[model samples]
Target: MLIGALLILTWLILLIRYPAKALPVSGAALIGLLLVGAWMYWLDTREARQLAHLELRLDYAPTRCPADRPLALTLKNGGGSPLQELRWRIAAYAPGDSVNLVETLYDAPRYRGPGELLPGDTWHDCLPLPPFRPGYRPDTLEFRAERLQGSFAD
Candidate 1:
């Protein structure tokens, strides 16, 4: 935006100082801005496009230690590009409850997964879950992946 503002300001100054060169200069500046905008738009949408092809499966099991429940994550990258990073929200809900029992965000960089997930590959790992309320066992467990974000390999 600063660049754009500077470009416009320069164009205006050029127009007032020298009208002969203003048309050609403004044309070049307009083209440059269009190309830059298009490039930025493409870069912003690349991750979302790749994420559309990803499949995630979340499951959990009872552990002897209640506080140490481990969540099993199955990630399938069906996109044409390899994934560089991933983030998702995991929420645990009890049966017949509208609110979640526990919620956590899983960040690939922080958690350190099995490295970059390649295209057409499936990666499975057991991630540690945030502790739940003591002695609060639900009759049924629910797993849902929400607000998934990921970056594709260059």
Candidate 2:
């Protein structure tokens, strides 16, 4: 924006100084600005496409463990592009006696993945969880992928 302002100020000064050359110079400047704007828009759209082409799917496996209460989950890259440095959310819940009730719920902090997840690849890991709230045991667990960032192939 500052550059644009300076260019416009310079153009106005040129117009006042040389009326004969102002028309052609202003036309050239306008074309240059339009080309620059179009180039910027194209770059932004390419970045958006890269983001859209990255997707993920999460699968949970139930297992029994006395101490850690470990939960196994698999994260799959389901898009055309590769994904890396993923952040995820893990949550556990214990259902209540009545329908649609949650007796106990626990949410862990955001989990950062270690390495890149190539296209069509799956990452399997176990999440160690502490015991559920007193008098409540988890009936459902959820693993969600969030804040995804990746690049698409050219």
- List TM-score per model, in order: 0.66, 0.47
Instruction: Kindly report the root-mean-square deviation of model 2 from the true structure over all alpha carbons.
Output: 7.1
Cα-lDDT of candidate 2: 0.58
Q: Model 1's lDDT to the true fold?
A: 0.72
Error of 2 at 144 (Å): 4.4
Residue runs of model 2 more than 4 Å from their true location after superposition? 1-7, 19-25, 58-74, 84-114, 126-146
| Candidate 2 residue lDDT tens string, 1-154 | 9999998899889899997899897889789999999999998787666556554444344543334535555666666666656654444443333232222334533455547777787777666543344564444634344455444444
Q: Given candidate 2, what's the lDDT at residue 54?
A: 50
lDDT string, candidate 1, 1-154, tens digits = 9999997798788899998878787789789999999999998787678888999887774453244446777889999988888877666677677676663335422343345888889997776665454565543567667678777777
Steric clash count of candidate 1: 0
Write down the worst ten-residue block by lDDT for model 1: 103-112
